[model samples]
Target: MTVTIGFVGAGGIAEWQHFDIVEARDDVEVAGICDVNQAAASEAAERFDATAYTDHEKLYDGEDLDAVFVCIPPFAHGPAEIAAAERGIDLFVEKPLALSVDRAREIHQAIDAADVLAGVGYDWRYSRGVERAQELLDGRTVATIEGRWWGGVPGDDGHWWREFEKSGGQIVEQATHVYDTVRLLAGDVEAVSGAGSHRLVDAVDFADSTSVTMEHESGAISHVSTTCAAEDHDAHLEVVADGATLRITEEEITGTVDGEDIEESFDVNPYAVEVDAFVEAVAAGDPSPIRSTYDDAFDTFALTMAANEALDADGRVQPAAIDDGTDAGEADQ
Candidate 1:
């Protein structure tokens, strides 16, 4: 059966990852494209032989879609996912989930009530290196975890990412991959304390240098650092297990595991793999192929949110203690 799909955001990620991956598959068809920018929507629609709309409601009304990709920005997450779930259309949402934890929880509840298949774009989870790392660390006891996301500012000086309100700072908007990967490697975090500085980047209001210390429920300690003042981009997650150290970068995983030397590299595109998984799950009428569902992604978002809260209170904050007016503690449960 051909899976008819619609795109709710025709921006960079939609074109580069979701659109290209789905276009390559003969079992799927791009039915419609939506963007607040009419030109972008029209251009993407013409390129993919689909219809374009500036409003997502119209796209949903006009198309017979099995699923839709919610590729909007960090702050623009709620309405599209809720509307699609209400229509019983499956969702493939991009990361960060939302700017607020309460909003993300509502979206999660909506999807659960609708009982539709959902996937989040935590694409790093789909990498071959991650698969191997899980295999190698299957039953091992983890010690200290180190995660880093050091990079220069993204987009232009006036880009939305520069604004903390819009992007949720560097940790939430970009380094979430590092946070999520570490959570996958080590267990859930029990408490978090963070410090941040905003001295370098004049246009950005948020912290340019941020460091977080997490106390894991597994009795393990984690230190995650991120900065937007660097000239080069460098990001990685390293897990120091008993007698083994495994490091995961975007292109490869290298280190010693199980008392043996190991170095594995992957040139594969995780974005394409994740999009393919979402499409395949939709086509097969199953959700098991998706590695990161909305609920799972919410845990990661909560962790970042806790870090932000920690920075605010200048004290250690439990992920469950966030002031989003909900039982955020249940997110980890």
Candidate 2:
């Protein structure tokens, strides 16, 4: 069966990651393309032999899509996902689900009620190096995990990502990949205490640096620190396990095992792997292979939001305690 897919956002991610991966598949067809920018949608539609619309409603109503990929920004979520779920269309959403927890909860409800297959864009979980690291650390006692996303600010001047309100700050918008990886390696976070500062990048209001200490349900301690002030270092997760230490970056995992040096590199593109997993799951009618479902991504979302809350309170906060009018904590049970 040919899977007809529609794209709700035709930005860089769609052009570079989703489009390239989906276009290569023989079992899928680009059915429609929609974006708030009409030109972008039209260009993408022309390239893929699909229809273009500035409004997602028109695209959904006019096209018979089996799945819809929502690649919009943090602030542009909610309605598209809800509409797709209402139409019983499978969904693939990009990370940092929404600008607010309430919006994420609404999408969650729609997906749950529809019982449709859904996947989120925590693509790092699909990295071969991360998989190898997971295999090496499995059944081992983890002591501590340290994750960081230290780098210079991304995007050009006046980009939406530099805005706190629109992009949900760097922690939510950029550093979330690291947060998700930490959760995957460590476990579900129980509580967080952190502080944020807007000391750098005067043109943007979002914090340039944030430091948070997390307590996981597995009784392991972890800390994730992020900064958009430096471009000289690498972004990675370092896990300290019993008798060994593993450092996992986007391209490789390096460390020592049993007092011997061991290093593994990844040649596979995680974005491609992620897209393939979503397509295969949709085709097979099983979402089990999806490492990051909307529900699971919500946990990462909550954890980051909790860190933001703590930054505001100048104290500690439980991730499950920040109520968004949904039972987000139920996933822990």
Candidate 3:
């Protein structure tokens, strides 16, 4: 049976990463498209030969979709996700689930009660470089993990991403891929301490450079720093384990493994892999193969939110403090 999918947002990521991939699939039909920008939605619908709607409620009510991809900005997350869950339609949501923890938890509760298949857009996990890195780190004790995202801010000065209230800053908006990868390789973050400052970019209200230190539940240590004011640098992760070091980029993984120099390159498109996995999972009614589920991505979001809170407090804070779960206490040690 062919699965009919609708897109709730027709932004860049939705158009390039998601719609393009799903459009290439033979067993899936692009049923509808929706965006706040009617022109954009109409354009996408024209390309796919699907109906267009300016509001998501109209799209949901008009299209009998098996799944919907919610690719809106961080601040515009809750409604589409909740609506899809309520309608028993599976969902593939973009990263940084919501701008605030409370709203994310509310959406989580709704999704949990509905029990529909759900996936998040942490496509980096499906990269062959990450796969190889995971394989190499399996039996080794990871000592220190360091990751960084150094680049210019996305979009123009008027973009929503530049506003902290709209995008949740660079940490939650852009650096989330690195944070999620760190959590995947290391483990759940127990506590985070960090500092941020608006050094260069005057266009955005948020910080231009931010540094965060995380303590994982498995006793691994990680430091992730991001800057939107610099020239493009390879945003990647380097893991130092017992007698081995692994450096992972989006396209390649290189380093020493057991005193032997090893390098591997990835030609696979992770976005395609991620989309295929979600489609297959929905077809089989089992979401087991999806790397980043809504709940798992929420943990990453909570960690980023905690880092932002720590920056505000000028001290360390536990991830639990932001999520209203068990108290992991302050990171004052």
Model 3: per-residue Cα lDDT at residue 165: 88
Candidate 3 lDDT by residue in tens digits, 1-333? 798999999987998788889889999999999999999999999999999999888898999999999999998989999988999899999988998788888888888989998999998899998999999999888888999988887888689998988999989998999999999999888888888899799988998999999989899999999999997765999999997899998789999999999988979999999999999998888999899998888888888888888776655788854346543346674
Q: What is the lDDT of every predicted structure here?
A: 0.87, 0.87, 0.89
TM-score of each: 0.95, 0.95, 0.96
Q: Candidate 1 local accuracy as lDDT?
A: 0.87
Query: Residue-wise lDDT of candidate 2 within 248-299, one digit each (tens)?
Result: 9878999988798898887999999999999999989999889999898998
Q: Which pairs clash in model 3? A: none
Q: Output the number of the lDDT-best candidate.
A: 3
Best candidate, TM-score: 3
User: Which model, 2 or 3, shows the larger TM-score?
Assistant: 3
Deviation from native of the Cα of residue 89 in model 1, angstroms: 0.3
Give the Å shift of residue 5 in candidate 3: 0.4
- In candidate 3 the C-alpha lDDT for residue 114 amounts to 98
Error of 1 at 4 (Å): 0.7
How far out, in Å, is residue 146 in model 1? Answer: 0.2
Q: Which stretches of candidate 2 lie above 4 Å from their native place?
A: 321-333
